[model samples]
Target: MSSSITTILTKKSYPPIGHYSQAFRANGHIWVSGQIAADADGNLLKRSMSEQAHQICKNTSKILQAAGSSLEKTVKVTVFATDFSKLPEFNSVYNTYFPQKPPRSAAEVSRLPLDVEVMMEVVALVDPGDEAKL
Candidate 1:
């Protein structure tokens, strides 16, 4: 398989805050960056952990869609949180989005961009011929 890389972008999702693409496609996989609880307009949401988790999931879904993939195709996910105590809260909201229970890892971080409560990154399979949709 070719190792050529293609950066993924979409107006439906928030633009990268720094020097990173929202996602990248290569070797039949889509690697999504850690998505914060921000809207398409780049407004950060500082609500409860559950709310932030929901927004993070939404942002991830949008990026995956633009990459010609979906949450259902996700193979792995990594979640970063400011507080590990709120993991249950995060999981409650996360389960609604990833019912298939893909492989996941969660870690407590000292901080996140925008001081958001949660951020999530995912690696998902991109079906053969799916790149044509982008």
Candidate 2:
């Protein structure tokens, strides 16, 4: 048996503080592992659910951009929050990043790392030729 998989990996901006990858690319798609509101140094960026969600989006964007892609190319997203109550606040911030709205789902988790309130992950198919923006 043989495999021709090209495992694209990046560890510069984000390291596995937990058990995850900041981002990886292969084939024609880039799979961005879950990103929290943590800095490159793996420190949680303190902010409200609104601010935290924004930071999470911003962080994800950076990882995508590093891989020659952007959120506009994202086809799917999943958000996990400690409570459904924070979702309202998260939405206010989420809309700021995704105005056009792509495929998405939200989950209420028992807890998140550092009790950070909210976290998110995304899947994106990128085309450097595409001019569409989100």
- For this target, which candidate reaches the highest TM-score against the unseen true structure? 1
RMSD (CA, angstroms), candidate 2: 4.7
* Cα deviation of 10, candidate 1, in Å: 0.7
Candidate 2 local lDDT, 8-83, one digit each (tens): 3444345666665677665446678777887767777777888788778888888777666788888899999888
lDDT on C-alpha atoms for all candidate structures: 0.91, 0.74
Residue-wise C-alpha lDDT for candidate 1, range 18-64, written one tens digit per residue = 99999999988999999998899999888888888889899999999
Query: Each prediction's TM-score against the native?
Result: 0.95, 0.82
Span of 10 residues, lowest total lDDT, candidate 1: 125-134
Can you give the lDDT of residue 122 in candidate 1? 99
Instruction: Give candidates' CA RMSD values in order.
Output: 1.2, 4.7
Error of 2 at 9 (Å): 6.0
Q: Which pairs of residues clash in candidate 1, taking residues 3 or more apart in a chain or in different chains?
A: none
Which residue pairs does candidate 2 place in steric collision?
none
TM-score for candidate 1, please give it: 0.95
Give candidate 2's error at residue 40 in angstroms. Answer: 2.1
User: What are the per-model numbers of colliding residue pairs?
Assistant: 0, 0
